[model samples]
Target: MAELRPDSANRHRTRVKIVECAARLLRAQGAGAVTTRAVAQAAGMQAPTIYRFFEDKEALLDAVAEHVFATYVAGKSLADPSGDPVADLRAGWDTHIGFGLANAALFGLFADPGRGARSAATTAGLDVLRARVHRVAAAGRLRVPERRAVELLHAAGTGTVLTLLSVPPEHRDPGLADAMYDAVMRAVLTDVPTLPADDATAAAVAFRAVAPDLTVLSDAERALLSEWLGRAGTGGDRGQRDA
Candidate 1:
């Protein structure tokens, strides 16, 4: 591989230093304390130097958020999944709540609709969530469509963290996160590990999970099968609602 030129290497290092310093300020003192001057002082560089790496304060904050969130995601990705997918999903939910509470300022930054909608790190984190939900579906434990399961978990986790953060630490309910996770799991999961003989929706969901691996079918055939399964799952869900 080609080596980075000295100037390019120095620029990269300088950018990383700026992001690290900003992240420290964010974690310790919140977003209000991460001004350009403060970050420059923390990084031992002139304030003007920050402009060379970042366009403005918002740009710098965006970088800092990405840096901090990416580090968290990297750690999560490295963890070995437990053999039980449902248990693993719960573990992931707990990890998410802990991360959000620990990184209040960073989590708030992500909660901003504009910032989160455009954040690459946020997208990466969601991808990890999607993978976990996919595993549960593959294990035939999921009753809802994989996408819906992921959305429900994601929404519930975010809401739980934000609610907890909104209250003083001493006032926060320790069991709130657990309660939210349990409620979401009940909505998305089958009561039993094995597919229920009477639950057509659960069967369709389980079959849908493995449909992509049905190699004997052509791509078009697989796509058609998936469409049918999706409708079947929806219909079963509707029937239950009507009952």
Candidate 2:
């Protein structure tokens, strides 16, 4: 093995420290509380040390969101790849629910609207879902949309997940959550007609180019968004009654 460079090792350690600090702050007080200075203090490093690894707060937040989301996706990634579309979709949904409930802080951080384009987790998750829809549409299991399915799904699913996670314990029900999600997916898939081969491919390409900026907002912005989402999340009796 090659000898390790001191500079490289130092850089790696600093990056890890920053991420750990950011994660801790996000967990304790939500994403809006994570600031460069706060994270540096938490990690026992100087604020400037964080800049050596991340260009700015947005980049650092993006990196943390990516790390957390990757863990979430890996836990739910398909294993068999047996070409069974429905099973694959269900597996993905189950993984999503499991991860969201277990890592609510991380989940909400990514889902917050203010992150703009830096939120790689939200972007990649939607990309994954869109790809699945494309494949299922190809095999005649689902309909295509006149408009892009990805955009529609993003709006609908984001609102749903945020709402579901905010439900009070006494009002939460896992079975109902799953059923509602299934129902929504089914309805969308049925109502929208599939595109022809060329159109489907084109639509897929367009969506790929329209990747959402998934960065979490500054600590202040996240606090505001989280508060709003928390309130909006509690208003529904729909599927997330127990979420």
TM-scores for every candidate against the unseen true structure: 0.94, 0.62
Candidate 2, residue 240: the lDDT equals 25
lDDT of 1 by residue, 77-123 (tens): 88899899888888899899999999999999999989999998889
Model 1 residue runs over 4 Å out of place are 236-243
Q: Which regions of candidate 2 deviate over 4 angstroms?
A: 1-5, 32-38, 51-59, 74-80, 114-116, 146-149, 189-243
Clashes of 2: 17
lDDT (C-alpha, whole model) for all candidates: 0.88, 0.61
**Clash number for every model?**
0, 17
Worst 10 residues of 1 by lDDT: 234-243
Candidate 2 structure lDDT: 0.61
lDDT of 1: 0.88
